[model samples]
Target: MSSSALPKPQMRDLLANCLRFHIVGAIIVSLEVAASYEFGVAEPRKKAYADSTKTMIPHKDFEERRKPGVFQSTK
Candidate 1:
């Protein structure tokens, strides 16, 4: 067996993959931000409108509670 051995090159591959992952992530985030701004799909006006118009539709449990009588499963 030789006293000297080649050093492991695993770190180089790991670093390259990490850099690539970050670059891809950055690109995806940038594109998403650009698309959001371009389309204005997430504007506050629409959100406010939705919030203002939001309402709760009562279900079977609510009706049963309101009557205050023997419980019956509507299922």
Candidate 2:
């Protein structure tokens, strides 16, 4: 109500600064969350290797071995 309390330009500047501060803070928080997700999420799972030199059976041989008559029983 009193002109001496605060001039119009200073009041406008103060209000503008407050709004800008809040907006900048929100943007910073959102960027921080995005950065954290980029760095922290989606780590690749490590496979355990008991014998690194062991080779996998060929697909054709594996299929034939599964057949009952194709593989003879030792007993």
Candidate 3:
């Protein structure tokens, strides 16, 4: 029997296939995370409203009424 060498796979084809797989996987993972956040955290956080306890004030008035050194670094 004659000895024959099997064809070697091209680097470009291997790299392309790997890149395509990774891109598809990343897209799927990102979509899943976004869906989970929208359903789990985003919706719940909005409805839970730890902000409800705090009074809402006008932005300009709040800024103007701030006491000096209140926001300054203690150092």
What TM-score do all the candidates reach, one by one?
A: 0.38, 0.39, 0.52
On residues 24-50, what C-alpha lDDT tens digit does candidate 2 reach at each position? Answer: 999999999988776666331112232
In model 1, where do residues sit more than 4 Å from their true spots?
A: 1-9, 41-75
- Model 2 scores a TM of 0.39
Which pairs clash in model 2? none
- For residues 1-75, could you state the per-residue lDDT of candidate 1 as single tens digits? 999999877855798899999999999999999888856865767777778667644575578675765556532
Which one wins by lDDT: 1 or 2? 1
Report the number of the highest-lDDT candidate: 3
The number of the candidate with the highest TM-score is 3
Which whole-number lDDT from 0 to 100 does residue 7 have in model 2?
40
> Which of candidates 2 and 3 is the stronger one according to lDDT?
3
Angstrom error of the Cα, residue 31, model 1: value is 0.4
Residue 70 in model 2: lDDT: 64
What do the candidate models score in CA lDDT, each in turn?
A: 0.76, 0.65, 0.77
- What is model 2's C-alpha RMSD? 9.2
Q: Taking the tens digit of each residue's C-alpha lDDT, what string does model 3 give over 1-75?
A: 659978886867888899999999999999999999999999888876757535555665556556554546432
What is candidate 3's TM-score against the reference?
Answer: 0.52
Q: What is the lDDT of residue 53 in candidate 2?
A: 24
